[model samples]
Target: MTAHAAGRYATALFELAKSSGAADAVEADLSAFRAMLDSSPELAGALASPLHAAEDKVSVLKALAEKAKFNELTLNTFGVAARNGRAGDLGKVASVYAALAAADRGVVTADVQTAAPLTKKQTEALAASLKGAFGREIEVRTDVRPELMGGLIVKVGSRMFDSSLRTKLDGMKTAMKEA
Candidate 1:
């Protein structure tokens, strides 16, 4: 599967970063680069486009990395991704890398969805609350999905804690129908 391949690449990158004492730095760069991919459709298209020559894609990636001032290790890792023609899976690679890094630090990630963006303080508070409940350091990734209408949904590993207004309304409708 693509995820399995991505996990292998991510493990290699994570091991390299760990041995070099730059795992945290590399993880941060991965997040930033993933964000860049999300924000730039043209860049994403170029990387994922089979029409573009691999060399050309590598050149464009190098130029963009230089402009962004990416560290040598981060740049090299991305170069490998492009060279292998796995550029479209870069985000998945980043996610896998983050998981590896967090596991190394004995932390877990929680995907949080809300109707609106949380402030930094709110995020910290949420993490603290989750830590108190789960007894593990929590890395929170928040997505603002307006369709939720209101409230928050937190997913950690196999467990989900959904308090979204949409779910509440749906439950109410089902109960009323049954009644």
Candidate 2:
């Protein structure tokens, strides 16, 4: 149900952004807002908590949007969501909106997690390989997961290729036990 609501909000925002030729700006705004949510737990709680009144949430969102200098479309979307009591779904809405925008542009997002940060050249190589394999332009989103120990994991859409050292070690342990 939350996803449905998020999708509806995202679709509406996407359509508006597309018509206004501000999709990229809106996407950047949402990405920055999501990063803000990640860094500020209080802000997230304020937006998501039922204890906060709708009007209060809208005001908070407005102030933050203005401070961030978000695009007009992004500010309006956030305001509407807050007023509709869907402010909590903003993160999900951003994700959905990004997917919609990428699909419209024939681009695919690859979520890559590596034990350490990838060099710029490595990132470009990986993206190129993915593009060749998928036959579509690839956008590589990378994260450093130290727990992985080594290697990398890549997820594109529903498909995941897990080649992390942690997974390999686990598999080896299982095999040794069976032996």
Candidate 3:
């Protein structure tokens, strides 16, 4: 249900942004806003908290928009979400909006996890390699997972390429036991 609501909200926002020629900017704003929410539990809690009045949540979003210098469309979209009591699902909306934006631009996002953070050059190189393989432009979002021990994992939609050392070790252990 929440996912449905988020999709509706994101689709509406995406349409508005596309028509307004601000799709990219609005998407960036939403991504930034989503990242902010992810990094700030207190802020997310306040916005999603029933203890905070609806209007109060709206005001908080307005103020945060100002502080963050969010684009007009982005700010208004936040207001709409707050008014519709969908603030709690803003992150989900942002994610959906991102997917929509990427699709519109004919780009695909790859969730990449590595044992350590990649340098900008390395990121670009990997994206280039993936683009060549997938035959589509790739936007790589990266995560550092020390537990991976080494190597990387790439996930694009339902497809995944796992080269992580942890998985390799597990496979070897399984093979040994079978032997």
Q: Considering TM-score, which of the candidate structures 1 and 3 is the better prediction for this target?
A: 1
**Tens digit of lDDT per residue, candidate 2, span 1-179?**
99999999999999999999999999999989988987897988889999999999989889999999999999999999998899999988988888888888899988899999999999999999999999999988887899999999999999999999999999999999999
Superposed by TM-score, candidate 1 places the C-alpha of residue 4 at a distance from the truth, in angstroms, of 1.8
Q: Which regions in candidate 1 have their CA more than 4 angstroms from the true location? A: 166-179
TM-score of 2: 0.83
Q: TM-score of predicted model 1?
A: 0.83
Query: Positional deviation of 104 in candidate 2, in angstroms?
Result: 1.5
Order of quality (TM-score): 1, 2, 3
| Structural similarity to truth (TM-score) of each candidate | 0.83, 0.83, 0.80
Off by over 4 Å in 3: 145-150, 165-179
Error of 3 at 87 (Å): 1.5
Give the CA lDDT, 0 to 100, for residue 134 in model 1.
Answer: 95
List, residue by residue over 30-121, the lDDT tens digit for candidate 3.
98998899789898888787787778888989998899898898898788888878888898898889988998989998989999999999
Q: State the displacement of the C-alpha of residue 138, model 3, in Å, after optimal TM-score superposition.
A: 0.7
Each prediction's Cα lDDT score? 0.88, 0.93, 0.90
What's the distance in Å from true for residue 31, model 1? 2.0
RMSD of 1: 2.6
